[model samples]
Target chain A: MTIENYVILRNKKLTEKTFELTIDAPELARLSEPGQFCNIKVSGELIPLLRRPFSISQVSGTEVTFMIAVTGTGTGILAKKQTGDELNVLGPLGKGFGIDDTFETAILIAGGIGVAPFPFLINKLKEQGKEIILFNGARNSAELIKLNFENELNSTDDGSAGLKGNVIDLLHANRKLFVNKNVKVFGCGPHPMLKALQDYCSTGNLNCEISVESNMACGFGICQGCPVHSASEDKYYLICKDGPVFNSRDIIL
Target chain B: MSELDFTVKIGNKLTLKNPVMLASGTVGYGNEISEFLDLSEIGAIVTKSISLKPRKGNPPQRVVETTGGMLNAIGLANVGVEKFISEKLPFLEKVNSTLICNIAASSVEEYTECVKILDKYKIIKGFEINVSCPNVKDGGLIFGNNLEAVAGITEKVRVVTEKPVIIKLSPNVSNIAEFAKVAKERGADAVSAINTLVGTAFDIYTRRPKIKNITGGLSGPAIKPVALAKVFEISRNVDIPIIGIGGISKWEDAIEFMIAGASAFQLGTINFVNPKAAKEILEGVKNYCLQNNIKEISGLTGSYEL
Candidate 1:
């Protein structure tokens, strides 16, 4: 990974609390893969000291985009960045989504801003000529991020969106469409949603991969700040190095 | 400018190319940060604290950002000495930088045993005994708080290696200089003053601790004044060379530590924020010396004026 000061291309507001920041970082965009992330320094000051880790939402040519939610001070500062500001970024970090030819169909599951990595993954899946089905869910219509992809289904807790339930419930209700096909599930969401998806995938005997999130100091192996328990071992795997993305069965979640 | 001496000696045996060293637990084994800047350009790279056996470290939520600092309870997670010699040393040997292995153990014998095993490696220039780590339930502060324990650990580890031994002192003490004195009297080559101060943070909504460990060592610009004071305190009371560490983020801070009594200084929390800090601070320090008409960088040590 490398640290570079990239010029901000655009900061478009996606929702009331969310924005999509595009940066002109040729090398980082070139090295980036779906599910991998970049650690962004929001300010030069030490108050918001640590660099904020963001998922690589999309990459086009020399531009890379991050789906940012103004959850705290760091991200709030990120949301206010302008078109010409320079952002110090360290990335193409962590293992990206594992795209192999093991399955013919790709079922993308995302909840809330967990939809960050899907736009990039969808582009890769398209290149492989794999059939893609996306199940997006959020709290309300205002919270849903519409990517305008083919074969897309959205769910909301309130009945203002496509399906009137969480993403997993929507997936269960529509299970017959892809259950018989050779499908692999890719999930990113809250803890409860991921747990629900893990159980669903396990009961159905499906292959799955998931992207997890954590509060990390260094978006590298050195800090040892972001750790997730290994499913098979007594040791913990660093989220920055071992994976931000891991096979569902390999990690305890 | 080329004639200006940037070298600083840490104790009688080890001389560093510059006064900027990467603090333990900040740079890990030195492979990740090496991608950002040349490690050989810096004074030294202190490896993360290693023990006799591998530690799994604490559970999730090991670090949290405070106001102007951060609190971390990493529990001294390392690959252990056996793994260090086999997996980590080979790469460090290639970096061509001064290597100081930080050793942490639950017992005095374990510290000496770890030193004994690492003493044979020619790449390792010195040892930084981590008796101040506040994360783990074992060794750490237990050995650091008691003067006798610090003296015993220093004397025993000194017996195992002829290499320079720098005792890393904890700031979470009533009188930090006393511990520095015991380290010096027990044959420690130098002392690194002001390890992280124990601090904690909480989430008001969740009504729980922010980190799983509850308490973590606080490091960043917030602790700079405290670290400078600790270095000055040790310098005034103890005759031993002091390697300052705590919240050293920039060259100005590094210079301040040297003036307060640090022979050399280690950049800790800054490494995480800016990976190229060591290289940048070294340049800043050199320019400061050249501008101030100081011929030797070491002359800044204990140059504080009341």
Candidate 2:
């Protein structure tokens, strides 16, 4: 968890609110794991105060790319950045996935911007020859933000675009495939979406993992502010510490 | 007592030269404002929460400013407990300030597991159990809302260490006083009030939410009134000491918390907006005592009638 500044190599719009940024912080890129994130320093003004946290969308050779949305001052400033501009980044912080052979079948569920952390996970799992599925949920087909993954896995769109309704609805619509075992479920997104995913996987008895979001001032595990409680099961897990990613059973969701 | 003698104790064992502290999460482990903060000048330093593992937190677009306050979904990102014990604690030890490691847990088990590592330190003066971070599902506000959880976890952690345990309570509740009373009865040494209120902000022009997460916990100068009111309610309900927190930006704000029955104070939200605000407060406390011909600062605590 190194806290340093990275220069923006490029910023391009992928959707109305979504954009992709390439940063020059080699150390952050080098250390980055799929589920981890960087806290972006607010540029040009100090009113925003603390940095914004983002899961590592993708990591390439000398640069790292994050699929970001222009939501507030912190990210709006980040979206507006040009090449050669210095953007402060503190990361690659948090735990990501380990491409274990034990997971024969893996599924990734992402909600809106939550789709950011999975592309790297997919590529990693592909090396192990593990089968993958992606169920993405947005308001509609027009709202679905897609990443150019090298043509792998089953893609489900919640809107009438590619599929219909919610991605979980599509999974339920295709529930017969889950009758088997040895499946690990990975999900990232809004609280309710994660809860829904947790329910579907648990009822289907699929092993599941999820990455949670929290408000953090330090990218390091210093702020107790990003606290999360596991369901009626074990205990608590920090979104910043124990996981941005956790076994679906590890948490209540 | 001289005006300077106004300082009082925060917990049973932790006595402050002044009764004000920078809340965990807001102060960033006392490093951000060491020169400006004079870390030793305040009653104590309540550090941000540390966990058993490292974290990455939320995705991009985690913070947004609301009407009177700001919303943040930063999900406590940290270097984990062992790293903090070695990396950050030593620096805190070097400073004259007594370190109260602020701890957060998602369950009765996680809180104990994380705090158990702290038991190994032997140097931390106290522990602040943060039961109210809005972003995490099991960790923050959930545990805070339940009375059984408030006492159950406090009692579980109480047996582990001899040091005082200060439970930091959440503000986003219909019954904050109920939570405070539970902490006092169960075995908590003191109770701190008003973690950030749950909130959200939007870009009206875009007609979309300002934060990518859609909703966040509100903090900063705007929450002072709500904090003062909560502090007042909980203090009246519980006999144990109350550490008031929320939007404490100035010495006057600190005084308001005291009168509201906070034996001590935590400066939240403002630390980032104004780095030197804590110093401004200490000086102001000194000046106010002198101007009012008040000798002890503790005398200001609960001076407000209603």
The DockQ leader among the candidates is 1
Candidate 1's error at B126, in angstroms?
Answer: 0.8
Reference A-B contact fraction recovered by candidate 1: 0.88
**TM-score between model 1 and native:** 0.99
lDDT of 2 by residue, A1-253 (tens): 5556677888888878888898877777778877888766666343566667888887778788888877766788777789888876766767776557497877778788889888778877877898877777676655567755543223335345656666677667665655575778888888888899989888878887888887666545444445566665333555676778887877654
TM-score of each: 0.99, 0.58
Q: Please, what are the lDDT tens digits per residue for candidate 2 over residues B247-269?
A: 88778889888888988888877
Output the lDDT of residue A196, model 2.
92
Question: Model 1, stretches more than 4 Å misplaced?
Answer: none
Best by TM-score: 1
lDDT of 1 by residue, A37-77 (tens): 99999988888999999999999999999999899999999
| lDDT for each residue of candidate 1 in B44-162, tens digit (9 for 90 to 100) | 99999999999999998999999999999999889999999999999998888789999999999999999999999999999999999999898899988999999999999999999
lDDT of 2 at B44: 81
TM-score of 2: 0.58
